[model samples]
Target: MDDVYVELAQMYDKFGISDFSVSFGDSMLKYFDCMYPNETFKKNLDICCGTGTLCGFFKDDGIQTKGVDLSAEMLDVARSKYCDVEFIKCNASEFNDGEVYDFITCTDDALNHITDIEDVKRIVKNANVLLRDGGLFIFDINNFDILTPGEYNKDSFNGYSKLSLVQSRDSDLIKTDVKYYEHDKLIWQKSLFERDYSISKLTQIFNREGFVLDSCSQHFLDEKRSEKWKLIFKKVE
Candidate 1:
């Protein structure tokens, strides 16, 4: 499974249809600046930092940043392009360090990649351990309501780039089957699995992990879509 994730991670930036991190990170930085006007974040970490997309944003903001993922191939690409930032290949659910971070982010719905509730608990617990007192943990999840409704299994395109997506939802599992074809040739295909959690269930997990929910907003900073929510959780003192 780890090797498969690594292979997908290596080709993600090249073959994946969406570049959500660029826009998502932009919004997060704005939120961070507005919410923490006087705060200074020296060290930051991006868990499940596939291709280091968000790490680029942190670097642009002059924050000393590091990235970790279970995919060594992904880290290799990130290291080649962003040599200044450190990249660690590790499992999100079991990572630890003697040092803690001032800020941490796990974006692109990476949390959903964990298909088990216990795995989610372990990952969040590890995140808690990696964060300083009062440090922030930011993440996002696809709304199960929208996902289960079968709206995601659609054919869409952005000019020349066409995307064919298939979604399967079960009692506790959500799977996405994606096939990307370009120039009439099949370029990529991947099956991604994630656990389904409501906003309330997510809140419960965060509270149990001793974190405060600062904000939860749906969609790309817009309420109209309301199909996905980005949440910010802060470590308690």
Candidate 2:
């Protein structure tokens, strides 16, 4: 199957992904409130949403929220967890539901997961279409520093279940080796890939599609110190 999360989806929520998503969603909500305190976001759409944890934050604020992802298994997990948030199965690059939203998010460094840069462009362009005029498009991507030649390793255990993750970066590509063990027996192992394009290049591409950078942050807006960057763009008329 093309969906890499087929097997991983079963154990994704138990792997601290949901916990991290809380902080991630908090960051977005904080930024939105800061930027548009006088106004309230009416609708939100999260592309590449995994388990709909991020959508919960918007839903809590009474905003109509929806999530989209390419993996059916991931969507299944999300649907089971978040009954209030609508979930759709489709590639972020090709999704066109003819519905407009006030805010669009594709966080979690999801852009890097698309290997083809053209698809990344398509995703951003499509976001522009799905966003109403003056709508916000927020997303994050791995920066050049993280996409350089490097290696990272980690191992974790949840009771009898163990997970080993080895991630490496060569040039612009990041490859991750994943191994899951259950009760001392290997259950599944695979390699996943991600690619990162430079922030400047993405800026130019988004600009061409009538999106202006509204804000960006690593630690602070316009600060470029961190390895991953969250960017906010406004769709222009």
Candidate 3:
């Protein structure tokens, strides 16, 4: 499972089709401004922070940022690029440190990679433990409304050398296959799996895990887009 991500890490940034980096940065800033109003938060933790994209943004904003991912290969690339930001290799569902953070983010549909509901609960519960009171835990997942309506079978290209195919095995499970090429020859191929859970189910698990649901919006900062849902939760005091 994770080995796929390892193979993909080297080309992850180049393979991104959407303007996700810009949109994500803008969304995070909007949320941060809304939460702080007059001050800046101290620390941020990015879960499943593949390639440490968001971590770099947070660091540029002068926030002490740390990232955690299950793939050591991904972290290796991240650490190689970002010398200041810390990138730790650990499971998002059970990873923990003694220190708590002011803000946490797990974007790019990272939570959807956890196929088990129990694992989702563990991840949320751990987020509660890892956050201070009033601290935010923001994550995004594939909207079940969008995911279950039809199969996720699509083909796309990233520039010239990278090709991607997304396929759904069932309503709940999605697989993304990527191929990289040099000229006409295939260099590598990799596949990654993701799972989708209903918003209602997630709300129940979050509440049970001692989190107060703050909001759930589409596209993070935007309310109009209908594909992804960004869920915000705060650790109950």
For model 3, how does the per-residue alpha-carbon lDDT over 7-62 read when each residue is reduced to its tens digit?
A: 67776776663236446756777877876687557698998888888888778878
Per-structure clash totals for the candidates: 0, 0, 0
lDDT of 2 by residue, 132-169 (tens): 98898888787757445444423343668877777777
* Runs with alpha carbons beyond 4 Å of true place in candidate 3: 17-22, 35-40, 147-160, 222-226
* Global lDDT scores for all candidate models: 0.76, 0.79, 0.76
lDDT, model 1, position 7: 44
State the RMSD for candidate 1: 3.2
Best by lDDT: 2
For every candidate in turn, the CA RMSD to the true structure comes to 3.2, 2.6, 2.9
TM-score of each: 0.85, 0.89, 0.87
Per-residue lDDT of candidate 1, residues 48-163 (tens digit): 88788789778987888888887778888888878888889888887776778987888877787777778888888988899999898888887777655342422334444444
